[model samples]
Target: MSRQFAILGLGYFGSTVARELKRHQNQVLGVDRDETRVDALSDMLDHAVIADLTDENALKELSLEAYDAVVIDVDDDLETSVICTLHVKELGAKEIWAKAHSDAHYKLLKRLGADRVIYPEYDVGVRVAESLNYHAMVDFIRLGERQFIVELVTTQRLVDNCASVANLSIDRDALFLVAIKRGQEVIRNPADDTPLQPDDSLILMGDLQALREIGRQI
Candidate 1:
């Protein structure tokens, strides 16, 4: 299935997203204020246009509502990003994902009606730190204040072959195996008898400290 997306702003962040979305077989429309940048991405994106997203009339003319998702990646101009986000929301876009330069920007974008806000710089730094320390930890997703869902490689010492709560002792305030990600297959709510493979990536959900302790033990 192919989803249509519109990317506002064609800076490094927006251009990268546009290219990747097109690579994944999605119809991507990239908008930018710079004609040179737009031309550079013309071959890479499904459609590339030079336009100012901050202008309500320009954004409305683009038919942004047609896109399943709209990504706002304007960092140089925060006001423009906020205006674009509001315009997209009012246009009835199914989803709008925006990028923020700081905490203030993030809050403003969220308030302006962006469905999701991403701080790429901060998020990348966190992921890089996790990857450097725990090579087995492939990814980390925030669940709550102190909770997280981590993707970790299963070890040989695990009692069971399948990822489940039976093999590992989880504290009352700690973590538990949520699922097993094996290759492209995901086994959710696996039974205790489920055998885990070393190649399997276990999706553990619970306290961050407990997950870290288990990772260290392995």
Candidate 2:
């Protein structure tokens, strides 16, 4: 389903979000104080405007309440970001997402009624660290506080020890095999008798500690 969104900053992060949202067939309105930035994304977004988002009056002129969501992406200036978020919230925008540069900024945004706060750099850093720590882990997705869905490549040790899915012995209470990927073939919810092959990609969902334990053996 398509939704309407207004982005209050046209910096790299905000522009990227606008483009991606537009690509998904959503209507996106890009706003920025910098004319150059607004002009650069005019063709990419459904609408582009050069306006001072920090000015509550200017923000009110945009009819922000009509937008399904509003994104405040002024991480460079904490005060401007906070003011813009407050204005959007006061205008009764259905949802507000704000970018935070620090813990203090994050808390402020939440207090001003932001529905979501994003720390892009911090999140990317955590993902990179996870990949570096787990050599066999191809990708990782956080499912909850202590649970994750991890894509791992089967190792020689794993194949030699288990041989088949049924014979595999791990923490059944915490680990569950979700799927197996062999080249172009994907076996979803694979049967217990499924044969194991070294280097095959396995998708597993389980607790973080259990996954890490299995990671060590595999």
Candidate 3:
């Protein structure tokens, strides 16, 4: 289903979101203070406006209630981001997603009624560090503060598919397989009984330490 999305700020992060949302067949409205940026994305987005998102009164002039989702990617402008979120909520925006520069900013975003807060720099840095350390680890996602979901390439040295996995001695209560990515295709929500093939990438969600331990053996 298509969604109506409004993106405030046309900076790097906001522009990227706008493009992706449009690519997903969402009707996107992009607002930014920079004229050049507004012009740049004008052809891509359904509507592109050069406006100050910080101005609550001006923002009120916009039909915020019409958008199903609002994304505030205004980086470094904590005050503006907060005000925009608040005003958007007041205008009946169903979902609000914001970008945070730091812990304090993240807390403020939550207080301002942001449904989701993204720490792009911090998140990207962590993923990059994880991939650098583990050659088998393709990517990592945080499911909770203490838990992570990781995608890793399975070793090709296994004699038997089922036997190799059974010998791993994984604690089913604490850790388990979630999916198998064979080549470019991903198998959704795979079961433990699913046979592992050489060169298959397994996606596992569990405690970070447990994932690391499993990665070492694989």
Candidate 4:
């Protein structure tokens, strides 16, 4: 289903979100203080406007309550970022997502009614570090604060040595073997005796520490 989104600030992060949302068939409104930045993406978004984010009257004119969600990305200017978030919240925005530059900023946004506070730089850095540390981990999604669902590719050596899932030294209770993927086929709820295959991708979910220990083996 298509949803309406208002993106305040047409900088890199904001513009990227606006473009991607528009690509996914969502109605995106891009607003920025800089005319040049707004113009750059005007053709791509449903509506692109140049306006001061700190002005409550200017924000009210956008009819923010109509949007399914409003995203604020003017993190460079603390005052503008906070005021935009406050204005959006006050204007009855259904959902508010704000980008925070630091820990303090994150807490402040939450207090001001931002539904989601994101630290893009910090998140990307952590994911990059995890990928570098795990050779076989293709990708992963963090669940809450402690759990994770990870994807690990099988190697020829793993198939030869472990031979089957039963032979794998995995903490059965700590980690749940979600499935195994081989090309286009997906083996869901694979049994303990399931034979291992070279180049198969294993999907596991559980504690990050336990998953990390097994990721090393993968």
Q: Model 2 scores what on Cα lDDT?
A: 0.90
lDDT, candidate 4, 58-144, per-residue tens: 999999999999999994788889988998999999999999998889999999999999898788888889889987878898887
Decoy 3 TM-score against native? 0.88
Each prediction's TM-score versus the true structure: 0.80, 0.90, 0.88, 0.92
Q: Which regions of candidate 3 deviate over 4 angstroms? A: 156-163, 184-198
Each prediction's RMSD to truth = 3.4, 1.9, 2.5, 1.6
- What is the model-wide C-alpha lDDT for candidate 4? 0.91
Instruction: Score candidate 4 by TM-score against the native.
Output: 0.92
Model 3 lDDT per residue over 1-218, tens place: 99899999889999999999999999999999889999999999999998999787778777887889889988688788888888888888888889999989999889878899999888898888887887778888888987988988877654253444456556677787887788788887775456677788888889878888877766
The candidate, 1 or 4, that scores higher on TM-score is 4
What's the lDDT for residue 52 in model 2? 90
Better of 2 and 3 by lDDT: 2
Which residue pairs in candidate 2 collide?
none
How much is 31 displaced in model 4, in angstroms?
A: 0.7
